[model samples]
Target: MNVSITGLTKEYGKKKALDAITMQLEGNKIYGLLGRNGAGKTTLMQILAGQVMPDGGEVLIGGQKPFENQAITESICLINESENFKKGMKIGDIFKFAGYFYPNWSLETAEKLLEEFSLDKKMKVKSLSKGMESALGITVGLASRSPITIFDEPYIGLDAAARSRFYDLLLEEYEVQERTFILSTHLIDEVSRLLEEVLIVSDGKLLMQKNADELREESFIVNGPRSDVSAFTAGKNVIHRKAFGSMEQAVLYGESKSDARKAGLNVEHVPVQELMVYLTEKTKGGVSA
Candidate 1:
């Protein structure tokens, strides 16, 4: 389903959690919702899921407001970082309830995932370890088959191997099912290849929303002598810069890779995770870059 947010604002006490954030997300594409802690990533996800109402503006799913709208909510599944399942419920009970709540819920997928994750249906939620609990959440989130699935740090306690399996399954599901997936994760580089587009939030504001490939192509690091680096980076958006003795390296946000090469500067692609860090640091004035 298509998601449209217009002037969305949320506040807690005197602080704004989200400030007039406006963006449109098309259906059936994977999106990376990225930001540091306290950057309003969670607030925006909650509001989008209809768990919290915005103080101003609106969120529309499939052209209808999702807040208190069962039709819209049924189509959206948001698996948060914590408090996903009740502590007292059995694993089987949780799956049963999920089947009823999500119209597109697939029992076959759920059962298969249970065996794949080595989760016993009789196991009570409280009895499961953190890794097991995360696996269960992943099972439900994927098997729920909601048109709009939002995973906010879904692999909290999962090991590297399990996480890799989850990534593979996610891509498989996306290709076959063709539904929207909104992923909020700090592990940007790991999932960067899977993201079609990215929405970056900073300090309760929308920083930038761009196609993932285009963003990567436009942003690069140039390295050369301090003077040459300085001249090449002049009149450009420099996200970060570092000096290595007489040599200097600067991260720039523009399509100037060829120009840098022409200027006898060494150019390298910046990983999405590093780019995010540099961008946020620049925004927060953590560095002079």
Candidate 2:
């Protein structure tokens, strides 16, 4: 489903968790909601899922407000990093509840995932390990078949293999069902390939929203002699720069890679993870990409 946010603001005591953030999320695409700790990624996802209300502005999902709206929220599933399920509940009961709560819940898919993750429905929530719990969360989030499914760092304790499996399943589901998936995770490099679009937030404010491919093509790293790099980067939007003796390297946004190469500097595409770090660095004052 399409999600629209307009001047969305949220505050807690003296802190503004979200500050006049405005963006639009198109339907049936994978989005990376990236930011550092306490950057308002969680708060923004909560508001979109109808779990939290904004102090100012609004969030519209599929042309309707999600806050306290059952019809709207029923199509949105948000799996948080932790505290997703009650410890007292059994796995079977949790699945049953999800079946009732989400109109598009698929028990068949859930059962298959349980088998793949080696989770037994008879087990109690408190008895599972952290990785198992995360697996369960992934199963529910995927099986819900919600039009807008948001996963906020949902693989907390999973090993590398398990995380890879989750990524495969997420992509498979997306290809088959074509739903909107907003993933808020710190593992940017791992998930970067799956992201069709990227939304970056910094200090509770919207920094930039751009197509992933375009961002990759526009932002790059250049390295060469200090004088050569400096001359090439002159008047350019350099988000980051460093010097190693006579050699220097600079990360630039919205610059032509071909032009940099012509200037005798080594040009390389910046990984999304590294690009995010440069864009949100405090020294840069959250420069927009």
| Best-performing candidate as measured by TM-score | 2
Candidate 2 per-residue C-alpha lDDT over 29-130 given as tens digits, one digit per residue, 9 for 90 to 100: 999999999999999999998989899998999899999999999999999998999999999999999999999999999999999999999999999999
Top lDDT hit? 2
Report the C-alpha lDDT of model 1 over 211-268, residue by residue, as the tens digit. Answer: 9989898899898899999998887788888999999999988656889899999999
Whole-model lDDT per candidate: 0.89, 0.93
Superposed on all Cα atoms, the candidates' RMSDs to the truth, in angstroms, are 2.1, 1.0
- Alpha-carbon runs more than 4 Å astray in model 1: 282-289
As for candidate 1, its clashing pairs are: none
Q: State every prediction's TM-score relative to the real structure.
A: 0.97, 0.98
